[model samples]
Structures are given as structure tokens and as C-alpha cells.
Target chain A: MSDEPVRRQVTLANPNGLHLSPISALVKEAMNHEAELLISFDGNIANAKSTMELMLLGATCGAVLSVEATGVDAEVAAEAAVRLLSEP
Target chain B: MQVRSGIPVSPGVVVGPTLVLGSENFRIPRKFVSRDVVESEMVRFHNALDKVCQDIEDHEILVGEQLGSQYAAIFSAHLQMARDPRMVGQVEDAIRNQSNSPEYAVSRTLRKFAEQMQNLGNQYLAERALDIFDLEKRLLRELLGESREELSNLTEPVVILAHDLTPGETAMLNTDYVLGFATEVGGHTSHTAILAGALEIPAVVGLGRCLAGVSGGETVILDGDHGQVVIDPDEATMERFRTSQARNIRVSERLATLETLESETLDGQRVQIFGNIEFPQEVEQCVKRGADGVGLYRTEFLYLGGNKEPTESDHYEAYKQVLSTCGDRPVVIRTLDIGADKVPARIRDRFAESQNPMLGLRSIRLSLQSTPLFKVQLRAILRAAVHGNVRIMFPLVSSLLEFRQAKMILMDVMEDLEDENIEFARDIPIGMMVEVPSAVMLIEEFAREVDFFSIGTNDLIQYTLACDRSDPSVANLYRSGDPSILRMIQAVLKAGEQYGKPVTVCGQMSSDPRFVPLLLGLGLRQISATPHSIPRLKEVVRNISIPEAERIATHACSLDLARDVEHYLLGELGRLCPDLVV
Candidate 1:
């Protein structure tokens, strides 16, 4: 329910960082929330909903990513992104 | 006289002369040839391979036209591999180098190629040896009479002895003339055993190298029950076997007759007898053996065997066949019970390695996480439920949270289907297998949530005692008749009683006639086992009174020790039916 853009920094812990399946799961959850979500790693940002784009980011394990969402569900989007990154 | 023993795949004893169909021994070429002559030989070899491929194509067409497309496709695939350009090139080079014949050339070349491929370190290509060798051998056999060595013409019902038989050869076997089969080098789950089971032929596989010396035309008796193949029996031994064979036949026939017979005790106590199957082929066998319904249909075989995920239609067709075959009989399909051991390395590559896969992310864990694959199976099952009686069950659920989470997903899938107006079974009884010790301990909670419970005794016994049944050294530790396991079963049954839901035992113990009396004594009304074991179990059930079983149950429960429980049950079994033991 936040109008302002919410940003959260999280480190990828999965040995295989945001592999296709987990990335897909995160993308699916992001789509569920009414938020314009973007994930940035090493100055590279990608649409959280685009599987192909997220894969192209090449974010390996132990890399830090700052995820930002701006919309009615920005809080929910940031919460989901933080939660997904913490899982193996 | 020689006797060989192996696990009996099917029931029936065969008394006949042996027939050995040995592979033609290949000899290395010793002669030298000029380059021109070698080149000519290579051309001739390639032509011979072409002819063989053509023959297989023709045979495949005929087979596809006669039998189903599936059988024809197997032959077609073999033909394609035989014509592989790489293999053709290899054979040609070998022949050009003065290989004795096309057979010798292909065998030698393929062996070298396979070793090279293995050394290249590509697992996928390396495993193609069987595929390549099998195809080339079939072609070589067409070129020379030696390839037909495995197929022998028999006029009498003689026990066919062999080292191994391919599925095609086994399928081509004259069932009427072939009484039984014994092999030296096939596993219990080998293609030969599966084909034999499909054909309802009594077979013993994995007999090792001893069966080679079993001469053709020597009088031999195959004891499928004990996996024993007896030769040159004395008059008394022959008489005893004849009696045993007749009894086995009668017992099977009697069980079949009881297909329409009620699963009721002499005291008029009603019971349920179900069958456990892993494939759709076993559904018809269940009907033939008089199974009231399917207790646990392992759906893993659907997802297994293919590289990619099985389409919804694949799952639907398979589930539909099973449901339609069962008709009104309730079929409880257990969602994929696959573990790290069964899954291919590629699919397993995605998962984090666990120290113990048996207790790791398997069964419910795998399905819950793999939504794409799980949804496909769920949708298929739900869609197939339109045909007949079908229910869903989850496996390896150690906690109520897992069970509830699975049920929620099922509900969501059903709701989506309802929104789409897809015809599916509503009010399908959902259940969980109480195999894990934790689940068994907390059965009361599971019983309240699920409509039914089926105890998978195989896992319960193994996990409870920390023993791997397959390891012969620790097989003693995997006793199902152990008091601890019995206590677990008793707990499950009591929980089911408290919740007023039907509980059944659907593991190996259910089929063992030795343990039947003990289980029956434990107040279990529903029993699901392998279809073949139905009649023996039914006979045991029909003979015992509820009071007698209850008394045995009391004595069994009083057993503080494990082996003592087995002893007590074995004694009871010996007294009740001495013949079943041997």
C-alpha cells in the first residue's frame, strides 16, 4: 500500500544463484503483486517479471542485488524479492 | 542334475527338458588382405547392414500393422540406430581392414567405438552401447543364421533356459509351447522379467552363470516359488513337486473363482482386498487376480522413463486407462514416490545433495516444490477421475503442515478446473501413506484430515529399524514382523478406528501369506497387496475366525521383542498352513 518506491538490498545465497526455476518462482510472485519491480546487481537492473532478462543478468551466487518496486504493492514486491533471495 | 534358484516372477511350476540358446561366439579376424580387397569387403559389409535394416523395417511394418503401434515403434527405433551413419562408417572401416565377416566387423568396431565414447567423458553417448550393439546384432543375425541362436523351436512345454532374452525375443516366444523360463543374467526388474510377467509366464531371472551348463533336453523342473530349478529329480521328489505344482495351479484358480466371492471371514466379518500397481499394464492383471480395487498405484512410472516432463495428455491417458479398468473399484493413485536413487542424474542435478536421500526431498517434497510437473500430474488425475472411481494420496509426509499444504494445492487445482468447467471427480477421498515413523506417531492428526490411510510397511519397517532391505547383510534388520513395526501398524489402525476412516496395509508384508494371519489378527479389514498374492491371502483370510485372529493379535501385541514376534507368527503359520512356508 506504499505509493513511494521501496528498495531492499539482499544477497543471493543459493549456490546456483537465482537458477531458472527459483527465478521463475520469484517472477511469478512479482507478477501477482500490483507493483513495477526492478532488480539491480552491479549497476545492472532488470524487470523482475521478465525471465529472459533476469537470466541475462548473470547474477551468480554471493552477488548483492538491490530490488526496488514502485506501485500500490511496492511493500509486498520488496518483501517477496527479499524472501526469494534468502532461499536456497 | 543341476538345480538353480532365483526369485519367482510369476506363479506355476514347469517340468520339462532344458533348451540353451547361446550367442554365436565371435572370432577375431587373423587373415591379412590387400587395400582393394579390404575396400570391397567394407562395401559388402555396408550392403549387408542395409539389407538387415530393410528386413527390420519390413518386420516393423508387419508388426505395427498386426500388433499395436508401440511394439512396431520399438523395432522401428532399432532399425534407425542400425542405419546410423556413424555406426555404418565404423563397420565399413573394420570390414575394409579384413574383418572376417559383417558380424565380426560390427562387433569389433562397435566395441572400440563404445570404449572411445566412454573415454570421451560424455555419459549420454557412452550409454548408447546397448542400443548400437543390439541393432547391429539383429542385422548381423539376418545376414547369418548364428544371430537366431536365442530363438529355438520347441514342440513340448519345456522349460526354456537362456542367459538373457531381449524384449523382442521374449515377446516372440510361443507361450503355449514354452512352459516356463529361467535366465542367468537378468535382474528382477529386467525387460525379460517384465515381459514374462506381462505374458503371465513363470520366470526366474538373475540365476547367474550356473544355468549355462543346463543341457538341452535334460529333464528339469523350475520351482518359481523358491526360484529353484531342479534337474534329474528322483521319483519321490518328482511326485512331491507334481503335487506342489498342482496345488499352486489350484490355488490360483481358486483365487480367480473368488473374484466374485466376498472378502468376508467365516464369522461374516467383511474385509477389503486391494491391489498395488505401478503401471497401467498391472491394472488388467489386478482384475484377473480379483482385486477389489487398487490400494496404491504409484504414478512415478508416468513421470519416469522420459527426459522431458510428461504432457498432461500422457498423464490423462494413463490415469484414464487405470480408472476405467478399475470401474467402481476405488483406485488410490500415489503421486510420484520417486527418490534420488530412481531419478536420472540430470533431473537430480537441480536438487541440493543430501546425506540421506530416503529422508530427503522426495515424494511430497519433490511434488510440492516442482509445481510445473506436479500441476501436470494433478490436472491429469483430476481430469481422468471423470471416467470412474479414483482418489489421490500423498507419500512421505512427515508433518501435518506438509499434508495441509499438499491438500491446499490440490484444492486450488480443483477450484481452477471448476472455474474452467472441466469435468472431474468431486469429493474424491484424499489420503496419505503412513510410512514415515513420525507420520505413524502422529497418525491421529493425519487420520482426522485425510479420508483414509494406507501403511507402506516396506518403508515403515526399514526406516523404523534403520536397515536397507536390499543389503543382504542387514536384511535381518528389515523384518516386517518385528514387534516395533507391528506396534506402528497397530497405532495406525487404532487412529483410523478413532477417526472412522478405513485403513489398509499396502506393502510387501500384506502379500506374504506368512504375515497375513498376524496382520489380520491386528484388526485390519482392508488389505492391498500385489495381485498375484490375492488368492493366497484370501484363502488365509477366509479360514480364520475373527476371534482366533484377535487372540493371535493379543499374543502378538504382548511381544516385547522383535524376533519373538516373527517366531510367534511363524509358529502360527506353520500350524495353520504348513505347505505355504516351503
Candidate 2:
């Protein structure tokens, strides 16, 4: 288990960013990990495992957000979030 | 997964999609549940959640099949949001602590979250917030649909689940689309129940608690025979339902084959079997059943439920519908016979309240008193008479003078139409209902002036035996097979025989297969009963010879007590067709 939060900055390459599908996909992926996942954009932070909260971030095309994960699977959880959000 | 027990008012098994009708606009019927129902309400809430989750899963599969799996991912999000502890937790807390009804708890919790999403003020996000509102509608539809007020706009065939139905609402139901109906609160004789029987729609009523666990559009199994409503029945129950339905269809097909058969005895004595209908829509039922004609088209319904007297067109169109449906077949229209208490609301107070409304100013007496209202219906019957064979009969004519006076009013209406030179059947046959004891006592004198005689056995037995038929305690005394009733019917038949006019027995007794042979033996060449009973009555009529029926009636009439007569008649019917007695 990691004590320090693993963080990565990612830009959404997909044309529709943090929209209904992507936000839902991120939540589904984030729920797979035993870690606390958070995605922050424009000073608005949302729990990566919550679809409504993640959607409320309202990130648009090419929007840059920070993905942070902390727990046993922090590394893979952050990597999954970054990879899912960066999908074109 | 929800089941409700109600009184099955109409007999049939209905497995179809449901359209629930009740309170709308998140207007919870009861905002709060009592402490006792709180646990039940909470359980009800979970059931709704489970139902909604299954629906979202179904959409996922369907959408995934049509488009790619990614396109179906949105429903997955909805599924998650529905189970989200934040939403469902709050809903449960409200139901548990505040005693809110499950419907109210869900509405409050979801609306709060939906409003939060909407208030975010981002165009893209606000539009996506519609997903939340859609989810809310899904939950409500799982519990119950919108109001009964929206029922008129139904464009598809669906069963109805409702809290209750008013007489007007039940009367106006379209038999074409509304396959069956069940209600949360109502008795065996409620409007929904009686009208369901009259309209031949499967129905269950008096479900003490319902609609809370159901949302609209679910496949419902309304077992009107057992008065059970099972929502989302298991595969096993559905399999049983299908097998029984197949057997029922076989029986129906056999009866349907009888549709084209004649109502004749082995000796070839022909009888005319007509339908007694309350609504014009039932004329199609009569035609399908091969009824001779509509022998009793009850016209009081046009007035009873409404605030004002039915306009001339309302009366005309209904008669026109029935007559045109019958084509050249005779359609007998009974004029307004509603008791003064049951008259249209506008003129209801005008008549003095009678102590015993049944014996009071009712039927021909009420019509004679309210000539203006009575004349409107008579004119319509005359105008629509040109459409097909239309005979006008006055209901509950207790005296010859009352019969003649009703004729005088009919003649007056005829003259008014004549002076205006409007088109109508000038020679429409006029008759009196042989229902009251006096009507039978003076049958010969009254039989001469009237063109025909139809023994209305229901009221005749009620008045003859001096018992209220609806009173359960005295139900035995209100026997239809009472000796006095048979003798009265015999007298009417004899009068018709002497006057050379046709006579038809039109009542519940005529519909009973047990009474069919007895009626035939009493020399009733024709009868009119509800459309539902005509098929079986025809089957019974076909199986028995006139001589057999004559023997049954003679033996029944010779019996000492009403009990002996009824017992003997049932034995005779059982002997005729072992399947019918049970």
C-alpha cells in the first residue's frame, strides 16, 4: 500500500471530454481499483468513482485535468484514468 | 416482482403490458406513510430500485445490440446512479425517519439532485442533466403512471392499473385498446367492475393496497378469475400462464365456432338471442356473437354520470352506433329508466327524494315527470330509427295508463319532429317493460296497446317478492326462479301469444344457462342478456330440445317453494350440461 498519492497530469484528446460516456467510462474503470481516485479540472475536484461528480467537472475538448490515486493500486488506477481520459 | 390481491370483478386471464393511472406531478397520494407502513414503504422503495435497475439493464442489452457496446455504456451510468448510495441512501433515510411514502421519498431525493445538476448553469451539463430527470420518470413509471385524466390519449393497447375509476371514466373506456383493468380500491359492484363485465374487459378491483410497488409499462398478469395481479411474473408462472392461456384459447375457439350457429332446438324451434348492452361499443360484441339484435340498449347511462341531460346528438349518436352495427336487425332502445336519485346531476335535486328509491319515481314515472329530458331521448331514438330496425320500450311501466301516457309523450315527440319535417322512422314500434307486479297483473290490457312485451325479470322479482336483490342477507328471497316470477313471465308470454306480438325475457335470469331451458319451456321465444353470456346461452339453447325445456319449466313451475324450483332447475341444467352447473 502506498502512503503518497500518485499524480499525473493528462489532457483529454477525445473530442468529447468528460461527457456522459467518457465520465461513465472513467467511473467504471476507477471502481475496479482498491484506491481513492480523484480527477480535478479548473479547481473543481471530483471523485473518479462517482459518475455525477466526474461529469460535474464539465471538462471540454483538450481540457487538462490532474488524476490522483492513493492506495494499494494507486499506480494502475491513475494510469487507467489518464489513459481513459486521453482516448481520442 | 410485485403482487396485489383484489376482487376479480370480471372473469378472464389477461397477460399484457400495463399503463398505470393515478396521481401525477409527483403529487404523492399520501405524502407520508404511517409508522406501521414505513417498513413496507422502505421495502417498496427497494423493489422499485430493483425494477429500475432491471429496466436499465434491458436498455443496455438492446442498445449494445443495436449500436456498439460503448453506445450502451450510458445506461450503465444510469444503473450506477440509481444504486448510488448518495441518492438511494437519502431516499431511504426520508422514508425511515420522516415516514415519507416511498413515492414521496424517491421524488424528494431525485428532484433535489436533479435540481443541483440543473443549477450548475453549464449548457452542456444542464442538457445532460435530462438523464437524471429521465431516470426519475423511470422510477415513477415503475411505481405508477400519470393520472387517469391522461387516459383518453392512450394510443396503444394496454392493461390499466389504477387507484380507482369513476363511473364516467369506466363508462368511457375504449374496449378496443384497454384490454383489462385493476383498481386499488373498489367493491364487486364498483363502476370499474360492473362496466368491465358489461364491456367484457377482464378486471379486478378492491385491491386494498396497490400501485405503490408498480410503475407503468411492465408486463402484468391480471387474473380476473382469481383476482390476483402479478407484476413481472417469474418464468415458471409465465409458463403456467401460457399453458392455461392455450387451453383457454381452445375453449374460446370452440365457443367462437358456436358464433355462426343458430339458437335452435333439436326439433328446430328457433329462438332469437339478443344482447343487453349498456354502452354502444358493445354492439360489436353482439355482432361478433351473432346476436339476433340488441334487445335491451340501456339508455340511462347517457345521463347518469354526466352533470346535465345528454344532448339530442349524444342520444342520437349512441342509438345510431348500435343500430348501424345491427344493420337490418332489430335494436330495441329502452328510454331513461334511472331512479330519480341516479338521474343526471343537473335535474337530480328537482325531484323529491323518495324513501325507497326503487319503488319511488323511477323508470317511466321519472321520465313522465321529466318530460323535457325524456322527449330529447325519444326524438333521438326516432331520428336514429331510420338507421336500422329500432323499437322503443319504456322501462318499469307499472300501469296501462302509464304505458299509454308514455306512448302519448312518444307521439308528441314524433309530432314535434314531424312539424319540423325531420327524418325519422315514423312507425317505430312502442312497448312497455313487464317488470313491476302491476305491469304483469294488467299484462293483457296493457299488452294490447303496446307493440311488444319484454319481461324484465330483475325488477319483477324484486317488486314481486318485496326484497332488495342487492341485500346479501335477503338474497335468497330475491330469487329469480321464484314461482311468482315464472308465473308472471308465463302471463306475459300468454298475453304476447294472445296479442300476436313478440315477447323477450331480458334480465340476469335470461343470461343464466340454468334458466334458459326453463325460459324456453315457459315459451319465451326470445331473450336478451349481457353480450358475455349470449355465447354460452346459445350453446345451451342449441343442446336442448323445446320439449325438454318445456318439461323443465313445467316441473319448475309446479315446484312448491322458490328453493325447490331453483334446486330442481339447477339439477335440470346439470343434467342438460354437466359442465354448466359448476
Candidate 3:
């Protein structure tokens, strides 16, 4: 169980912006891994597990967000969140 | 604890637990929990969240089944937002650290987030604040154990206390469980008021923020007769209301018995009691109340609500529905009378603005000027006339020229229909509303041209007194009991008699029980009012003799002051029917 955090930056690709559907998808994907995941958008940090926290970030289309995770699944979770955010 | 008065739109008395329906901007009270009870407050918060989530999920599934997946997906978003961990954590933090109650914590946290979203200045993001507010209200309602939706799942009969009920909400009400309703907003002509009257429930509207003082399950005394609501009444007030309620029930029972009887005076002179309805659905109520026919079916409602102009077929369908429902009963359909403050922006923008719209282009004037619009309505009326006994009435005909011009348009439509070989009633009785003082002064000329005359006392009184009824500052001066208005009514009745044409009073005055004897005495053989008041009006009509009513009318006309006329009529009404409560 590594305490070191894995970090990745990804740009939101959805044309309609990060509304409830995209936020729900990201939260569901992050919850699949056993890691403490955090997403920061425009200097505002939010827990990736919280749909409302992701929504509060108000990350619009093409906005960049940094995904970070700390635990055994840190690498996988960070990669998954980044991939989901970068997906069409 | 306090008494509030408003305009009574429907008449009855009821006492029951108040069911306060949640509305937009409905506020939840903030309270603090003890420090030791912080954990319990957090538990309550989660429990409420779980309940709201389950409710949303159930609704989503129901919508998915009934509608398609695309429509149902909207509720899925709501569900995800409900279970959002960060929002739940924020609420829980408030409950634990600040010792805030679960409802207050949830409300405060959601409001903060919603404000943040709204302040983002993006239109899409700002709109999301509405979703947060909706969730907050739903959660708070679940925590408070009140139903989140209006007029749904009411287990017991109760008086509904609301800020206001939209026409759609008022339409879906289960009248069996909704004993009565009171709102903080609306007037006598609002959709809520008209619906309440049609449903035959006790309702008082325009209480103005008194609803905020009331909570669910509190006992309330709603006097729909006097338009009063007493919250948490004391022993004395409760006893008086109880007596009044019992007496009202007895009086209603007696009135119900008169529904099957003829509206005749003691001398056996029969009178025609008709109903004035705004919607085609009200035709059933008119028939149920045993109205001889519909004296005034205001068709302006066809133009009011919808986004687009009503097609000729739309008007035809409405008229057909009323005519079919009435069976052999005569249904007098009044043409579109939209103008003044009643004109919507869609129609108003098409015309030049009038500074004094009340005296400007409206009713028959607007109809004549807009030939295409008038012809479409005339064609619809003529087409619907084939279904049953349909009568056409033109409104606000100030002069004989306007009446003749309007009649000419009707003739043109009739010729067009004949050319098309569309079957229609050739001799459908045409009438004119004697509303303007000019029309009243020239009643003999109007009587000669029209098939019948229906005195529209509402506008006649307003025009006669030069007091706008909608203007609250001078509404009290818009009295039907004013001798000048009564004399105008008298003059119309004499014209109808001389021409051997039927004369009807289709106005608020005819519905008022206090004014019924005076109207009967003035020799108005036909009277039309809201369907709810028909039975009560019939009860008054059946009890009085024409000679006695005539004597009262003569004396009332002799009285100089409006107050004196009202006082004398009220006294006579009491003497005529001691048990009747007006």
C-alpha cells in the first residue's frame, strides 16, 4: 500500500460541459478503485467520489483538471479518471 | 392565533388541519440542535437524504416506463445529485459542528452551493441552481414529514393552505379529500377562484402572506362565506365557527333540495336560472346545478392561456363541447371580449396601444376592426350551432352601428358557410350585452335589432360609476346596488318587455343572494351566475313572490345612496328567508 500519490492532468472533452451525467460517470468510475481520489479544477479541489463536489468545480468544456489518487490503486484510479474526462 | 380576511371566491365554512403545500421560495425554519444531539441530527439528515433518493428513484423508474428513456434520464440526474457525497458531508458538518438541526443544515448548505452556482454568471450554470433548490425543498419536506407535491397523496380531508395554486395544480385536486383551500394570492377572477367555484369548495384567496404564519397539521377555521381564516382559534371563536359550520351545512343541504325544483316565485311565475361559465368543462357543473341553460359562456379564455392563437377549429370544438353537454338546453356563447388589462402581450402587440383601454378598442370594437379574426370566430360559432341550440351574443356594443356592423360580419360568415354547404343552424338567436351606458340609453334601438338582451351589470356598473373594478383604490365604489345602475337595469328590462324579448342579467349582481330579490323585483325573468351559486339563487327565487320582490325593488330604486339600497335589500332578504345566510 503506497502512500505516494499519482497525478495526471486531463482536459474535459464533452461539448455540453461537465453536467450531472458526466459527473456521475466520473464518480462511478473513480468509486471502482480503492484509492483516495481528488480532482482540482482552476485551483478548486474536489473529491472525485462526490458528484456535487465535481459540479461545484464548474469545469466547462475544454477546461483542464488535475486528477490525483493515493493508495494501492492510485495509478489505476488516476488513469481511469483522466481517461473518462478525456473521452468524447 | 390570528384572524385574516380576504376576498371569498367560493362559499362554505370548514374547520380542519391545514395542509400547507410547498411552493417555489417556500422557506424552512432554522433551528439549532443541542451539542449532545449532533450525532442524532446527522443521522436524521442522512435518513432524509435516503428517503428523497428512494422517492426520486421510484419516480425515475415510473417515468422510464411510462415515457421513454430520454425523458426518464432527467430523474437519474436528480438521483445522482441527491446521493452526492460532498453535499451530504457539508450538511453533516453543519449539523455536527454548528449544532444545526438536520433540516436547517441541509437547507443552509444547499443554498450556499446554489448561490455559488448562480453567481457563476453562466446561464446554463445559473439554471442548475434551480435543481439544487428543488433538492433542498424535497429534502426539507421529507425531514418535516410533509408531502412534497401539491394535491397528491392526501390521506385525510384537510383545508389546503398555499402561497398559490397554479391552474394545473388546482385542476388535478381530489375534491373528495380537499375540503377547502385558501391561498395568499389571487383575486375573484383568477383561475384558482374560478376552479374553486366549479369544484363547489370553500375557498378564500389573496390572504397576503398569512400563509407563512400557518404550519401543517394546525387546526384552522376557514369561513368562505365571509372570506376569513382564523388560525389556532380560542374556545369562543371555535364555538362560533362550529355553530356557523353546522348552520352552513344545513343551509347547503336545503339548497341542494332546490336543485330539482323550478325557479319560480310564490305566485307561480317561473324564471329561468342560467349559469355563466368560462370553460367548456363547466357545462357539466351547470347541468348538474339544473341551470336552464348557459346564459354567458365567456370565450375569451380560448385566447388567454396558450402560446399560439387558437384556431377556428379550436373555438368550434369548445363551442361544440358546451352545446353537446347542454343537450337541448340553450347555450349563449359570448364572442371574444379581450381588452383592457385582460389582453395578453401576444394579442396586444398586434394592435396600437390605447392609453385608456377600458374606453378604447375592445370587445365589439376590436372584433369589428379585426375582420379576419372576427370572421373566424363567427364561422366557428355558426359551425358549432349545428350541434345543438347555440345562441350568439356580442359584448360591449355601445351603439346600434357597432351592433349592425357585427351582425353584418355574422351574415358574411353565414353566406360563406352556405356556399361551402356546411350545415348550420340558420336562425341561431343572436343577442347583445347591454353593458355600456350608451347601450342602456339606446336599449329600444338595440332590442329592435338583436334577438334578446342580456344585461352585463359588471361593466355597466363600472362604466356607470366610472370606477374601474380592477382598481383596488376605487373598487368599493363599483357597486351594483347604486340606484343609477339599478335604473339602467330597469330600463333594459322595460325594453325587453316592450319588444317581447327575453331579458337576462348575467353578472356578479345576479349571483349575489342579497341582490336576487331586487333583480327579481326589477322583472329580470332570466338570471345567470357562476354554477356554484345557482342552487342558492334558486332557493331564494323559489321562496319569494314577484309582487313582494317588485315592492322591494321599487323601494330600493327610490333609495338615493348605494349603502341605503344595499341595507334595505339585505334586510328584505333576511325577512324573506330568515334561515338563509348571505
Candidate 4:
């Protein structure tokens, strides 16, 4: 099995930023796959499945975030997170 | 010492140490926990979380049932935030790693998150910080084994100072130890103000941020008669307030002696002073205040305070209790008068959306549209009438046709009762509330059809002035003392006299002491008002002669400006009763 990670860059499109609702939504989406998800914003990396870590990132509207995943379904999980984050 | 003024809801003067309650920003005590007790601390944290979640859920259901699902969504958001696994994990981590007390950990963690949210610079998201802060306080309070002090536990009499109070909180206040209350927010017509009036507690609301400066145990004087709050007054100010308070007590005691006396003017003219009540329990208050009868028994409250539409038995039980309480004294029950902002969501959703509900389908209009609902209330009134002297009145009857239609419904209900051989009041006196301008124009025609007329000045003035009373932007124009409104009332009274049909003023105007003389001068011999105002109204009634009132009424009717009319009435009331507080 390959150990290399799948990664993508997504810009926050929600006018409200990564507030409780959007962060919770992201966490719920991240937990759906077997991939280990990590989101990095402004030099701070947070576990994509942790609401507290994502909220602490304070990734507001228009901020670009790096989503990295490493597992069998890493491609699927990373793609889904990027799409959800970029959707207005 | 400083003084601030607000809207006076109930009339009286009180001086006591302030009891500042319901501060949303409660201080959380922080402490360090030993390594051995870390597990216990986590348990305590989870227990507090569980309790808060339960409370939020219960409150959500209550708000959902009482208001509707729309308003109940607010509590749901709180519950979601509280139950967030990430937030819970963060708090527990703080407790174990930092060795912080569960209360401290929760407070610090939530505060940090809230601060970050506030810094996000989005107004809507920033406001969410308040929810987080509220949850933090609730959790901390629960973990610390502290519950919010119940207003019922107050030992010494105090003047309660608060930012604001919900209707439920206001209702649960123990009036025995509550000398008065002053709030930072609320208008004259707010539910807290209404509850204060019902409980006969002097209250000054809408004092703004000035109450924030007041601390618990600090001496403050609340003068609800003038809507003034004096914080930590000097000796001279204190002395003056004490004298004023003593005078108020003496005046009330003296007025209480007039309970048994007939409400009569100096020239031997008789006036009927009746009590306006919302609940059956207020009947005892009406009797205590020496009301001749129940002037206005608002039946709409039966529809409210419940989730679904009230059944016929619900109506029958409420009406029966009120009738039995009033005994033989005539109880005038006004039919369901719901509309505007007050309509229950269940019934409200059934009707077409109204742009302006106050002027739209409301009161008799809504009742007529929902015939089955209307008939249930009518049947209940009829059934209750068998217990005592009960009269039915239809509110907001604009035209003779509407009046006749409502009467026809009542007649049909009576016929059904007769067929069933159910005992009912065969000859119950039915009346129409003269509120709309159209009703005023058709008063003479209405007089011929209805047994009597009751002037509901609250809506009449609002409609006549083309102003919504609740709209602060136009509130200045919604004066009951407007010359146009006065003329309209005089017209109704003249028609009543012409047709020999009795007319009563059963609005806020009847309860206002300033308008008592003017109402009497307008030849309104019957007044139904809040029970607490009856004694003062009777005092004003006994002080003036019919000739004097007629003179004031003539002059007031001629004035074109509402301000001029109000000035003239105030001056006349002051002259007639020099010692009376207007």
C-alpha cells in the first residue's frame, strides 16, 4: 500500500467563514472516509476531523486552506473536503 | 447619587437596597485541581454538560410549544454548540493536562474560543460569541454546585434591578419581598410591565444602561409614580423620598377605606366602576378593590398559554370559574380578540398573510372566519352564564352587519343549547365594542341593535389617529386625548343617551387617573379598568361634580390639538383634586 498523501488547496467561499456551522459540517464530512485528514491555514495545521482544531485555525472567508489526506480513500476524502469548502 | 427616568408602568414609591439579578456575565471562580482528582473533575464536567444539554432541550420544547418552531430554533443552536464533541474534548483536555478545575477549564476554554470568534470581524459570527459565553456561565454554575438564585427566596424586601426579565421570570417573582423593580430595558407595553401592573408592583422599565452602575446591597429609591430611580441619594434626597413614600402609603390606606363607598360625584351623580381582568384569579382582586362588577373579561388569553387551539371544555371551564368567582355581580366577557402580533401561530398560519394585521383580519373578523372556533367560545359563554350574571360582548365590531352576524351566531348556539336542553342564559345581555371609526359613524344604528356599547378607546384612538400604538416612530400621534378621538367618543355617548342604551369605557383610558375627570365630563358613567386603579379612579370620581366634568368635556372637545387637550385635562385634574398624584 502506498504511504504518499493526497493533497488539495481550497478557498473558503462561505461569507461567514469557518464558523461553528461550516467547521462542524467539514468535520462531519471528513469523518466519512478512512483517510487521515489535516487542514493547514496561515502556517497552522489542524486535524480536519476535529471541530476544535478547525475552529482554532480561524480560516475566515477568502482564506486558502491546504487539505492533506493519507489513506486508501485519501483521494476521495481530500476531493470531497475541497469541494465542500469551495462551494458557496 | 444619580437619577434616571424611565416609563412608569405601575404607580407607587419605594426605597430599599438593590437586588441586582440575572447578570449574563457571571464571574467564574478559577482553581487548580490535583493530579489525583483529574478524573473526578472530568466526571463533573460531563455531568454539568449533560445537565445543561437537558435544560436547553426542555427550554427548546417549551419555546416551540408556546411560541412556535421558528423561535424554538434559537435553543436548538445552543444545544448543538453545547453537545459539540470537539468543544467537549477541548474542555476535558484542559482539565487533565492543565490540572484546572472543571469550572475553570470550561470557562477558560469557551472564553478563548469566544474571543477568537469575536476577533473574526464578521458581525453575525461575532454575535455567536454571546451564545458561547452564555453556555460557559451555565456550565460553570452547574459544575460549581451553584444555581441561579430564585426570585422567590429573597428574605428582605428589595428593589430588583436587572437588564431585563422574561415573562416567566417576572411572573415567578415573590412580590412579598419585592418592593419594586427597575430594568435596563423594556417599553411601557412590554409583558414585564404588564405583569408588574397585574401583580400591583411598582416598576420602572427602560432605564437603559444606568442600572449597570447599581450594585447589590446598594441603597436606591424607585419612584414608579414618576418613573425615576435615584441611586445612593444624599441625606436630604433620602429624607424627601421617605416623606413621599410615606404619603403614598397613607394615600393608599385612605383610598382603601373607600372600598365600601359608592362611586359618586359631589353633585350626587352615580358612576359604575368595574374591574378589567384577564384571568379568573383576578376576580378576587376585583372584589377586593370594590369593583361593582367585572367590566372587561378578556377571553383571548384562553387561546394563548397553550400549544393548540383550546377545546370547548377549556373555554367552558375558564368561563365557569370566572362566573362563579364573580357571583351575582355582572361579568362582561369580551369574545376572543386575537390578531396582529398576538395571534397564536397555529391559527395565524391558517389565515392569509396580512401586511398590516392590526387593521386586517382580527378580533370579530377572525372569529367570524373561524365559525367553529367562534361557536365553541359562544357556547362556553352561554353555558357559563347559567352560573351567574354573564354578558357577552363582541370586540372590534365595525359595521351593523358584523354585529348582527356575531349576534346571529350566538342566537344559533342558544338554539342548539335549547334543543339539547342544556342549561344556559336565555336572556344574556349582548353588547358591541365601539372601537373602529366605522363603528363610531354607525353608533346610532348599532345602538338600536345591541343591548349596549363599550368604548374600547385603546384601538379606537389608534385607528382614529392612523397610528400603531406599538410603533415608537408614530407613538406620539397615538394619543387617546386627541380632539378627534374625544369627539368620536362623545358622539358614541350621545347616541347611547339618545337610545337609552348603557355605554362603558373599558380601555386603558378608564384606568388612567388623568382621564377620569374628562371621561366623566363626557357623560361616561360606567368605567371598567385594571382593578388596582379602581380606588384612585373612585377618588377622582368623588372629587368632581358632573357640571365641572361637563365643562371640561366641552372645552376638551373643542380643542383641535391632542397636546392642548392633554394639557387642559391635566390642569383640570390638578385643580379638582389638588392632593391627588396624577
Better of 1 and 4 by lDDT: 4
Q: Sort by DockQ, best first: what order? A: 3, 2, 4, 1
lDDT of 4 by residue, B454-550 (tens): 9998788878888764454555676878888888888999999999999999877778888888888888999998899999899999998999888
Question: Chain B, TM-score, each prediction?
Answer: 0.69, 0.70, 0.77, 0.76
Worst 10 residues of 3 chain B by lDDT: B22-31
DockQ scores of the candidates: 0.01, 0.26, 0.36, 0.15
TM-score of each: 0.61, 0.62, 0.68, 0.68
Q: lDDT (0-100) at residue B563 of candidate 1?
A: 80
lDDT by residue (tens digit), candidate 2, A4-86: 99999999987866787777778788878999998999998888877667777778889999989999999999999999988
Question: Model 2 chain B, poorest ten-residue lDDT window?
Answer: B22-31
Report how far residue B484 has shifted in candidate 1, in Å. Answer: 1.8
Question: Number of the top candidate by lDDT?
Answer: 3
In order, the Cα lDDT scores of the candidates are: 0.73, 0.80, 0.83, 0.81
Q: Is the docking of candidate 3 incorrect, acceptable, medium or high quality?
A: acceptable
Clashing pairs in 1: B5-B227, B6-B227
How well does candidate 3 match the true structure in TM-score terms?
A: 0.68
Model 3: colliding residue pairs: B1-B231
Give per-residue CA lDDT, model 2, range B1-582, as digits (tens): 668877666778888777767544233344577999888888878898999999899999999999988878878988878867557878899889998777667765765566566667777777766677677777866765544226666667788888777667788788788889988776553335567889788898877645645545567898987789998898999998998888777767777888998889888999999998888988998999999999998886787676666799999999899888899999989998776334555666766766777778777888898899899989999999999999999998877778889899989998999999999998888887888898788888887788998888767887899876344355447777778888989988988999898999887678778899998998888989879878788888888998889888888989879888888988887887665543
Candidate 4 residue pairs that clash: B521-B549
